[model samples]
Target: MPQPYQTQAATGGGKDQEPTIIIGIDFGTNNHCSDKEKVPSAIYYNEKGEVSWGYSVPEKASPLKFEWFKLCLLDEGDIPQNLRNAAQVEAAQKSLRESNKRVVDVISDYLRELWKHTTRNIRRAIGGQLVDLSRFKVIATIPAIWPAYAQIRMLEAIEKAGILEPRIAGETILEFLSEPEAAALATINDMHTYSPTNMEAGDHFVVCDAGGGTVDVITYTVTKTDPIRVKESVKGEGKLCGATFLDEVFQTTLRRKLDKISPDAWQILEENGALSRIIHNDWENGIKPQFRNTDQHWLLQMPTSGLNRKRTHDQFRFSDIKFDAKDVQNIFKPTVAEIETLVTDQAKTTKEKYKKEPKFLVLVGGFGRQPFLYTRLDDQLNRKKDQTEKTEVLQGSGAEPWTAVCRGAVIRGLELSEDTIESTSRKPNTVVSTHHESITHGFKNDFVKPFKTMKTEFIYSTVTTPPERCDETVKRLCKVRWSSVPDFNSLPTWINPIGKVVRRINYDVKMKSNGVTLDFEVMYKNRVMASKKIGIDYTCCGSAVNQFHDSDEDSGDD
Candidate 1:
């Protein structure tokens, strides 16, 4: 039943309120949400001069190609190494700015078109009801590796969308859930369908999510105790080592081929239609139907017919290019080796900690969709399992790894609504200043005499001066204001006493100087304290002071 959106009281009591449309937007550079419940990371312009998605563009249409455009914008540096054309590069730069224009701009314009096309079936399947666009809660999934500052920027962009207007529900409103967690959840849901009590205590489950930008892993121990908890022990994380990386490798291979065959035509293709973008788009789609068959002739499909006539390039044009699967294998060997090593190491680390062999390893993501990838993974895991009898490799469809993550996030969100922390029954998992002032310095042997103990006020000054410079000393004092009394005596006296309060603290300290530097250390009336050294640098004057000391001077000479 579709319900209206409403806010729940902080006390946790709420009725059967309307289910505000909860939309999960997975902003992968290679994929975007295309439908109500489906998102493909691709965008295409249609014949109507409008945008379309998840489909090939028609020849009659004036199309603008966008693949992993969201991820492209995150880069503050030059364009990707694969792209070298001045014109296409300029166009891509312009598209990136347009894609990021306004959150709503993308949504209402390009994204909405994709959504309408893709979600037509989903909406029909779901009882012929349409989403209440006026009041939907938008939840986006972001890469966990993004810096804290970057995550905040994404949130700010979403807020500017004006969709979550008026009373925004905290946590439940707009949130960024980790991608792998969502994928793991989706996998668990599938696994549970067959065996409700399948994963048991001490059973280890390894999850690999290979997406547009990164490959992330999460290993967990499944327990069948009362609540059936799954606890995460480790997270294998890295940037999109998936299709995008492969695109780069393929482009380099083509570039080398072009150089060998015809450099003149290569320059033309470089200017007009670089095969890099086409390969990148194809790779991101999780299929290279042509690349799969080594014996068959794969089309380079460049824009110019004149250049095609002159270029008898190896892979650049269909000039009876005779390259075997071995050639493609050799080209991708580095990336394949890297992927294998990362997965193997992550699995080994988890297995070592578990003591027992892992029962199942679940692979998900765009890269996981490759039949070849599955074969390779299976072989690797089988070899490892050969040494031990307990381990097994369980295979799932690679076509939709993100589904698990989205389902899991939704389930998790529902769990939060009921005030339950653990959904062990549903899935096999257990998921989980101030400164002081005041300073005292003491010197030993010979040089220690001008002032046994030196102290200055004004905390946080690290300037030093000569002993004769009394005029250089500056005093700093701070007043106290508190609703309640603070225990200043309990605080350490070694630090210059400021003032104390029940709720806060304040302090003032002197600075450090040469020949017995004055280091101002302070303790506030409250619980706050800090130290600052105001003194002259003796190194400039050739004095070798091992440590600086604070001087107690009312004033210091300039």
Candidate 2:
């Protein structure tokens, strides 16, 4: 039902065709951003059946408001139990029940609105008909610890939202990058500038993406210095402890104190939506960011008349409730401790693997900039007496901390496009072809022995749990064979430790999506050596394996 757009090289579009543009989207639980500026991840449906979202949502609480719906994409078991009872989650669940909409539908609706704004912003920046004529390559960031199914659901929502609606299958590529990876890409350069230790190849660093609804931590080992390529040192870990939890804690504490002083005042505020307004305006926007462990005081004015009961306490006046440094610190303690634990664990993992602490611990995200959070992490993690032994704590430079993930997503897309262009330029004379869908899984092999033929067996399984080996649940999909082998004498050779000459030919077996079927290709040095298309009896599900082996020994006919 979706309309297909023309590819960059499609006929009829002449010299007026614009170059492809890359866009990065970070869809967070508390906020969403396509660029440097973020909008709150809140949506509201008015009584008149009109919808408003993000910054347009009303300041007053409404029964139709929806927040924290992003986590609803995950299976119930995947969500942390503590977050299940959060106010935003409860409101979203209620909204879904009343509207008879699924989580994907809600997500799609929000994304559709976001895309509209993103396109407008793009047109304003570049001008002309560039937006319509240019092919778009979108890189969306997802939490590093999200399961594969959640990632797939996110892709589906993006497609349904019309972001990829007018897309020519493989031409308009939509790729997913881990949030920590994206954040690292955007902030690592800044880290290099501020870090005391000189960053170099093989040096490891940890990226802690402490956002609104989740804190994800990952360790990366730098592979290249110039262009900055890194490989994951360990599997990333994450928890539901984020800045939003601080808001909840503060609100809960306020409610408890208010009820103890005057239950009538608390009831009046709740009924009139004054409580929600105070939390959003005074706490979330003001006190949460400004808290710095110093003895500072904050006053929240009570808007209801029921608070005129003349309550006299050091922390409370007749018309307002007072919050001191200790009150805000208490609200931040649990959440900050959780984040500290996550970062410490990642540092410990890196130390165990590489025999030293991470060279730097880079923090990025909306919450990553909080003075209290950064101060606590630095004090706890970098307390080493020797400066060289300490892991340098670096905050994302200015607003870079807030937009790092989305910006990093764009950087990743550009890198991929550059790689593609570079590869094509190297083999200008060769006819390069791409399948309808992008490659998903690929395996590389090195050959030291000469062979006339090579055969690869493709196997698949539908079981929920992956098999350790090719067992009963695993079925053979098909076999691809390369019959005419390239010349071994022309390939490069290297000497082994035993002084034996070895010819090493590296090739990758890549599988591309083609609706219900799959197209497989065996590539050698970026050149397609062999390819095969196979039909599928089942939809694309579960895991796959490509077993490679030589079909025949060297004939010695050379």
lDDT of 2 by residue, 148-191 (tens): 44666687788899987764323555766667766776766655
Best by lDDT: 2
* Number of clashes found in candidate 1: 84
Off by over 4 Å in 2: 1-20, 34-37, 44-50, 55-66, 76-100, 124-130, 167-172, 192-197, 270-277, 304-317, 384-388, 401-467, 470-509, 512-558
C-alpha lDDT of candidate 2 relative to the true structure: 0.66
lDDT, each prediction: 0.44, 0.66
Instruction: Find the 10 residues in a row with the least total lDDT in model 1.
Output: 415-424
Q: Residue-wise lDDT of candidate 1 within 1-558, one digit each (tens)?
A: 001122222233343244344556666655554442324455565446566656553323222555444543333332234332333335445664654443224433444554345335445544333342223455466654332223444554455544344643233355555566556566666676567677766677777776644566667666543344455555545544565566666667666766776666566665554444455554434234234424443444444435434544534342322345665665555655666776777678876776665677777765655556656666776685357644455656423423333233232221111110111011211111001122232211111112222222121111222122122221112211122223434423232234322221223322332111223334334332444432322221211121235342422201
- Clash totals, every prediction: 84, 0
